[model samples]
Target: MTRESLCRLDEKPCDVELRRRRQDWRRGAEAAYRYRQREEHLDVPYEHVETVGAFPLGRWLSDQRRAYRAGTMTGERAAELEKLGIVWDTADHGFEQNLAAARAYYDLHGTLAAPRHATALDLAVGQWLTNVRRPGGLGKDPGRAQRRAAALAAIDPDWNPRERGWTVDWQRHHTYLAQLLAEGARLTAVVPGVTWHGEDVGRWLATQRRDWGRLSAEQQRRLGELGVRKAPRARRTAAKTAAASGPRTGGAAFQKGLKALQQYIAREGGLPGRAVVERLPDGTEHRTGIWIANQKARRDKLDQAQLQALADLGIEWA
Candidate 1:
C-alpha cells in the first residue's frame, strides 16, 4: 500500500488545489466504497449509476478529518474491509493526504480506482474548512462530514467482507481462466489444433492443480494476466515427461534378489543355490538368480516376496 502524506496550504499538495479537487469528493469517496464491494477491479458500470439532474448538493465536503491511526476502527468494520480485499498495506503508496493514501491503500489490495480522482482529497477537506472560516476563518472541520459519508455509504452497501473477499477471489477467478488457457496450449502443443472454451478451460485448469490458492494475490494476478490458453496442457505433458525421465521405480524382493545375485557374481565363483543359478542361460546374469530366490520363498518356505527385494538390493540373499 502507498504511504499517504497530507500537504498543507501552498505546500506539497497545495491545500487550495486539494480543496478544489474536493468538489467531487463525494463521488470519489463513494467510488472507493463501491470498489471495496467488488471482488475484482471493475469500475462502476453505467447501469448502476443513478443520475439526479445533478448530484444532490450536500455538506459532506467540509468535515475536518481527525488524524487517522490504527486500532481506532476494528472488529466488524476492519474484518468487513478485509473481506473486500482491503489490506492496509503499511508500505506507503506515497499520496500527500490521509484520504488519498487511504484510497491508494485500498487500491493496492485490489479494489478498483474510480475515474473521479482527487489528487489530495484529505488535505482538500482540511483546506475547504480553512477557506470557509466561520466566526473564526476555517475551524477544524469545514462543512459537513456526513454528506460525504452518506455518499460513500450509498455506494455498493452490499459489500460484505464476511460474505465475500476480493483478493483471493479475484485471484481465483482469473487464474482459473488463465490456467484453462494454458492447458489448452499444452494440449495443442501435444496434439495440434485442439479447441477449447470456457467450460473446457475451467475443467482443464481445475483438474491438475492441488493447491494454487496458496499463492499470493500478486502471484495469482501474474499467472492470470499470463493467461491459461496452452500452459496447463503443456504442464501435464511436462509432468508426464519428467516422470518418464525419472529413474524406473518399483518395490520388491525381486530387486533386492537381483542386487544380491550381482554381488554374488562379484564375490563367489559359484552359487550357493546352484539349482536357482544353473537354470540361467550362460550369458544371463544375476537376474535369473533373483527369480529363483523369489520362487523358493513363494513355494518352499512360503515366505512373502519381502526377502527377495532385500536380496535384490544386494542387502541380503536367500
Candidate 2:
C-alpha cells in the first residue's frame, strides 16, 4: 500500500503540509503536558494527558506500526517513531508468542484451519501466514523456516517441521464466513469486493470468480511507491515477447540491463559509481548497457517513469 492508502486506512488525512504542522504540534503538546504537570504538582504519565487540539498521535503511531509490519516503512522512519516511544519491537508486542501458537496449531492440523472456536489472534496469524512473501520470491528461507520449526517443536514436541506449509490451502472456510456474518461484520470490507449478504453473496462470489480485487492501474503505481515487487503479469509479458521474437537482442537485453541496474540501486542504497556498479549483485561489468542506463540516470537523462522506478527502490541518485 502507498502512504496515502495507509493514511486512509488509519483515517488520517494525507497532507505533506499537515505532516509538517503535526511535528510542531507534537512539540507543543509535550511542552503543554510538562507545564500542566508542574502546575498541578503531579507526576503523570505522558500517555494519560490529552494534548491540545487532541492531535491524532495515537492514530499516527498505529499507522506507523502497520506500515512497519507491512515492510513499507524505512529504517529512518522507524527510528523516528521509536524516539516518540512507539515501540516497534515485535517481541515486546507479543507477536512471537502469537506466531508460535499459530505454528503449533498448523503442526497439529497440517493447515491453517479456520475453526469455529478460532480467536481473532488465530485468524490474524493465519492471515499473516497466508500473505507473507518469501524474500526474493525464490522460496522459503531454509534457515528461518528451520528455526521456526525448532521453536514450534519446543511447544509441541511431536511437531514435524518438514511438512510444507504451501501444500495446505490457506483460504478461509465457509464456516469462518458464517461466523463473521453472525458477528454482524461486513464481509465485503474484510475481503474486498466479496459481498456476503443474504442475496448478494452468490452474485458477489461469481463476480469474484471473474476478478477478485485485481489491482487497478493506479494501485499498481501505488505498489511501486510502496517498494513492493512488480506483479507477475509484467514478467510474463516480457517472457512471452522474448519467446515470440527469438533470443533476447538489443531491446530485450537493454530491458534486463535496466532491471539489473534498479536492483543494484536497491541493494546498495544509492546510485552506484562505475567501480561500485561493477561489484553490485545484479549489475553488469563497467560500460555494459545496464551500466550505461545507470550513467544516463545519474546524469538525469531518464524520464519520470525511470526516475520513479529508482525512487520506488529508495534510490536517490543525488
Candidate 3:
C-alpha cells in the first residue's frame, strides 16, 4: 500500500477511538443528569454507582474532578458539569457540607462543642470538626485551610477548644451553664441533678468551684463572666477536714457513687456493663459495676432516699 493509504488506515482507528470516548461521555452525562434530578445535588459519594444503565457515575465524576484539578479538563466539559451544579473542588464541597451541619448545631445549642459522636443535619459534624481542628487536617493548601478556619470561626470563635487551653468537655459544660444563666437560672439552683443536654451541669459546676484554683486564669475569667466563683475558704477547709477523716461514711460513699454513676451515664448514655470501671474527673476510680451489684444485693438494708436515687438513675432493681 502507498504511504498515504497507510496514514489513512491509522487515522481511521484514531477516529473510531475518539467516537467511542464521546459516546461514553454522553452516557455518563445522562446518568449525572438523572442523579441531580433525584438528589438535587451533584455531590455523589466516591464509591456510589448510578443504578441507571449501571454507570460508574461516581468514579466518572471523580475522574472529571481530577482532570479539572490538573487543568486537563476541556472547557466544554467543565461548563457542562458546572451547569449540573458540579463542584470542581470536592474538598471544598465536603467542607461546605460539614459547615452547614456545624451551623445547624450552633443554631440549636448556641455552641459548637459537639461530642465526637454528635450528628447534625444528617452529617457527622462533630467528627468533622475534630478532624479539621487538628494540624494539617484541613489539607495542605494554606489558603484553602485559612478560608475554612475563618468560616468555622465565624460560627463559633472557640470552635477549637484545644486552642483555647480547654477540653471540649469543659467548653460544652461551660456553654450549658452559660445558657442556663442566660435563661435566668441562678448559680445556686445549678446543684447536682440539674442537667442540660444530658450533661450533669450541677455536678460539673460544683467541680469547677471546688477546683477553681486548678483552672487557668483565662478559664477562671470566662467562668467569672457567668458569675461562677470559687468555693469559699471555709467550705474548702471543711472539705479538707472531711478528707482527713477515715474512709467516707455510708452517706458520703453513696453520694460519691451516685456522682460517678451520673458521670458514666453522661458519657456513655446508658448503664455500664458488668465489667466496667468508671473513673471520675478528680482522678478517683470506682468499680461501678461491682458497686451497683453490691447495692442491689443489700438493697433491702438501704435507706428510702438511697433506693430512690438508684431508681432515678434507671436501676431496675432499685
Candidate 4:
C-alpha cells in the first residue's frame, strides 16, 4: 500500500489507530503472499510488506508464518489488497501536489486533463483534443493533465487494455477518461475512488453525436489520429495500432506455448506445475515440459530439451 494510503484517499489525518488498523490488514496480506512463493523465504512477497516500510513482518510474521494468513480470498479481493497496500506504502506523497500542478496547468493552456487511460503521451493529447472544440484547449491545463496522466501511468505503465493479465484494468481505462473530460463530458459521483475514464469519453461523445461532421479540423484530426472513426472505440483502436507496431515474435510465441501447455495440463487432469516450449517442423511448435509439483523430483529429471525451450522463451525453470 502507498504511504499516502497511510492516511485515506483525501489525504486526511491518519491517526495512530488508523495506522494500526491499516497495518493489521497489511500483516494478513503479507502472510497470504508468503504462501504463494515456493522460495521459502521472505524478501517479502510484497503483498505482506506495507509501503515505504520495512514493516518487518510486524505481528503477522511474529510467530507461525507457515500458513496462509489471509485465507483463500477471491482473486479480486487479493488483488485489491495488494494494490491498496502498494499505493499506500510505496507510492510517493505528491498526489495532492500533482493534482494541484495539473489544476494550474489546466487553467491556462486550454488543455483538459488527459485521462489515466492514455497510452502514448502524444496520443493522450490527441485523445484530449478530440473532445475539445476549442483548438488546443487541452494545452491550457497541460500540467494538471500531465500529473493525472503520470498518476495513471504509475497505476499501469505498460499494460495493454485489449489483453488480459494478472493486473486490474483500471489504469488502462483512465487514459481515455481524460480524453472524455477534454471533450467536455459531464461526470457524476465517481464510485468512491473509482475514476471513470473511457466510458466518460464515450458519454461526452454521445452528446455531440449530432455534430460529427460539424467538428473542426482539430477534432477531425484527433479522431483520425486516434483511429476512433473506423474503430469507434479507443481501446480497440489502441490495440490495433499497437499490434501493428508490436513485436509479434515473443508475444505470439508465448500465447502459442501457453495455450498448448494449458491444454496439456487440462488433459493430464492438472498441470505438473511446469511447462516448456520448443519449435517444431511445419512452423508449429511443441511443448516438452514436466508439471511435477515435487521440487526435488522435478529437478532430478530436468533435461536438455526443457532447458533449451525455456531459454527460447527467455525464462529459466530451474
- lDDT (CA) per prediction: 0.37, 0.45, 0.85, 0.41
Kindly give the number of clashing pairs for every candidate. 42, 0, 0, 39
Return the top candidate by TM-score. Answer: 3
Better of 2 and 3 by lDDT: 3
Report the lDDT tens digits of candidate 2 across residue range 1-318: 577776776744456557876685465436444544556422223354345555444444455568799998778766654554445644334536566666665554443442334334345654444333233221266665566545545544433212423122212223234444454443322222233222233233333334424635443343334233332334788788868989633345444445555434323334455544333233335343345555455545555655555455444572
Mark the 10 consecutive residues where model 3 has the least summed lDDT.
183-192
Candidate 4: where is the Cα deviation over 4 Å?
A: 1-195, 230-318
Error of 1 at 138 (Å): 47
Leading candidate by lDDT: 3
| Candidate 1 per-residue C-alpha lDDT over 124-153 given as tens digits, one digit per residue, 9 for 90 to 100 | 432332222223221234343333333322
Model 3, position 317, has a per-residue lDDT of 89
Clashing residue pairs for model 2: none
- lDDT score, candidate 3: 0.85
Regions more than 4 Å wrong, model 3: 1-21, 37-40, 45-55, 235-318
TM per candidate comes to: 0.18, 0.24, 0.67, 0.17
lDDT of 2 at 254: 46
RMSD of each: 24.5, 28.3, 10.7, 26.9
When sorted by lDDT, best at the front, the candidate numbers are 3, 2, 4, 1
Q: Looking at model 2, which ten-residue stretch has the lowest summed lDDT? A: 161-170
